[model samples]
Target chain A: MTNASAQAASPPWDDVSITVIRRDMLRFARMQLRDSGAAEDMVQEALMAAMTSAKSFAGRSAFKTWMFAILRNKIVDHIRASSREICGADLAGSSDMDAGLEEFDVLFNRRGLWNPDDRPATWADPEASFEQDAFWTVFDLCMNKLPEHIARVYTMRELLELDTAEICAELGITRSNCFVILHRARLGLRECLENRWFQGEAR
Target chain B: MKMMNCKDATQLMSERYERTLSLRELLSLKVHTAMCKGCSNYGQHLDVLRQASARLRAGNTSGEP
Candidate 1:
């Protein structure tokens, strides 16, 4: 073994506290479930699972990473169970965030060229805005404003950092369609941020 | 390969996050962004948006909305 690997201390997973991460876990669950009651149940189950499997944790990852991994697996299962009950109806409709197409039309013509007027102007002081808490608030609001299904897809792909195949299997979307949905989500988010945060108050 | 316009370039820019681009797509995006100021500006906006998203998540772990 290398000297660095031998010297590196393993995190004390045994003393890890679940209470500390409870709120963050709940917030993440609520974002995915949009239902507080279900979110609570999921969090409870995740904590229980973590406790049971604490001995199995080899400390290769941080305590928080291990905990959240359990929580995310619970979420994936929850999404799967809920979609199953709906008989593929919701998952079938998952990929259709095409309502944002009109916004795309405003930016691009039938020939796929960006409209001259719609070209983004130089954003004023964008880097500085990242330091402001209020900017993140507006950014959060804009993200929440995305259509429910599309927002979920974006959340799964971007926030959860799930791979495309996992997302496709969980959401029942084909790869090509999944890419289109994510693209539209980014476009919609970009426009919303432009209107509400970037150009709105930054100017 | 079709002539990439500003619209296609912007879409490709976003897709770069989710998947690998074809060589043709990359070359097209390169040529298009090289000449199109609008697409280039959009690309920069995307970079800021990505950074903002990362910062937002970082703050979230501390329990802020």
Candidate 2:
């Protein structure tokens, strides 16, 4: 089919190509900001930016991927601008991870322990109880509870679809350190979710 | 079979699972996991968590959340 004919045949937003991706972008924004209003704003901003800069897309990657990249950059910009006061030191130094790690070390050491191995294992069958809204609510709560640095790294890498190398460069961390941060973030989230959603259900 | 320490296994299996490890590192992890129930279980848990998170995120996007 001709490109025009194909384009005409597809619904503007219902087109399978962009529909799910757009939704994912919105969901990611919500998860990252933990505010539906801000998330919707980010989605609209990303959509506008993508549409205006369509020519710059280059088509080297999927359109959704490109759109996500734009959204991620926008999110980072929003976060930076919004936290200007708290992250002034982070903004001044190129190495956010180093500064973040130092802060984490102090906090973590003060807590007198890193691992929560003493806590009971609490695994749930996602297949049965995996309602989306509830999951994200729990997920968001867990993510928000994480240390700021770990959460930032985890969000950028997983939710924003950034490469580890890019995250390392942006956060001024080595690949190994990035993985360590991510691992800790994941472990913490797992425990949090288990306690809040899974185990709580039993009680 | 012996079990890998949680700390070391967490590090090794994480990189291995992400496909970010070098061949040598990957081989070492494979060897370690071969005899390590704890590492194996950790890997399983990580995989489950990843899938569950992705599904949850996708569900939210589709308005099921």
Candidate 3:
């Protein structure tokens, strides 16, 4: 809705060609799976499956959205299959990222007051950034940089919009533990965002 | 309620979203943040993160603008 972006358009999806779609799909899969080869294979698999179910293209969603849905399901299926094999390990040890605790520690001093250097600064016009693609790129990177277990809990609570009780049940964690994890997640994420994105602004 | 340190105050700030704080916890947090600009700004940053993630929940994977 910003005049600049409205006039310019974005993501350069104007091509909207299969090549473009495939590339975009691969990018998303790579981010989610964090494995280049695996992402490539999943996108290939999704493309093939989409061709077969082309008839199911009831025009309910955009082509990219439909394709993404297929790709996401494939990724989920892959995770489910793999996690089934490693189920015990995953349940027994979705450990808190110790580095996150260190990050939390640095935020305050021995006196339990904010460290002058690590103290939170007011972000400049943060809500205005929600509509910006470049901002999301920074956001995604900050998200991905989180330790896997932290990222997992954060994705469940924030992206999936799950309630804390539901998240605790799913993770087999106590309510208090879930609260701590969520708090640590917000702390780490906000710090990362500040360093990566807001730090660049002339404040 | 005992006074909350910045670390505990920030953690409580996060929990405030997931659950209602007891009156004591809420009052201590209120008293601390009322006097501490750093914790107050930290609370605002947490709100920004919440809003940003909500966009992802709305199905915008990339390129929100």
Give the top-scoring candidate (lDDT).
3
Candidate 1 structure quality by residue, lDDT tens digits, A87-171: 3656575334355545556778778887665667678887677666576666667777777777788877765667889887776
Residue pairs with backbone overlap in model 3: none
Docking class of 2: acceptable
Candidate 2 stretches greater than 4 Å from native: A2-26, A33-38, A49-88, A91-124, A200-203, B1-4, B17-39, B52-65
Q: Which of 1 and 2 is the better model by TM-score?
A: 1
Candidate 1 chain A, run of 10 with poorest lDDT: A7-16
Colliding residue pairs in candidate 2: A133-B65
Q: A1-203, model 2: which lDDT tens digit per residue?
A: 58875554432344685667776777678767767898889988988887777667655555655677788789888865665553454533546544444332321223332344423243556655555567666766887888767887777766656778776666556777788788777667766776777676644
lDDT sort, best first = 3, 1, 2
Best by TM-score: 1
Give candidates' CA RMSD values in order.
4.8, 6.2, 6.6
- Give lDDT tens digits, candidate 3, residues A1-203: 57684444322234456676786676566655667899799989988888778757655666667777787678666754665443355544545324354667777789888888878887889766766678878876887887666676666676545687766666566788778778888888888888888877628
Clashing pairs in 1: none
By TM-score, the better pick of 2 and 3 is 3
Candidate 1 RMSD to the correct structure? 4.8
Overall local distance difference test of candidate 1: 0.71
Report lDDT per candidate: 0.71, 0.63, 0.72
DockQ of 1: 0.44
For model 1, the stretches where C-alpha displacement exceeds 4 angstroms are A1-20, A51-60, A93-103, A109-111, A115-118, A121-132, A200-203, B47-65
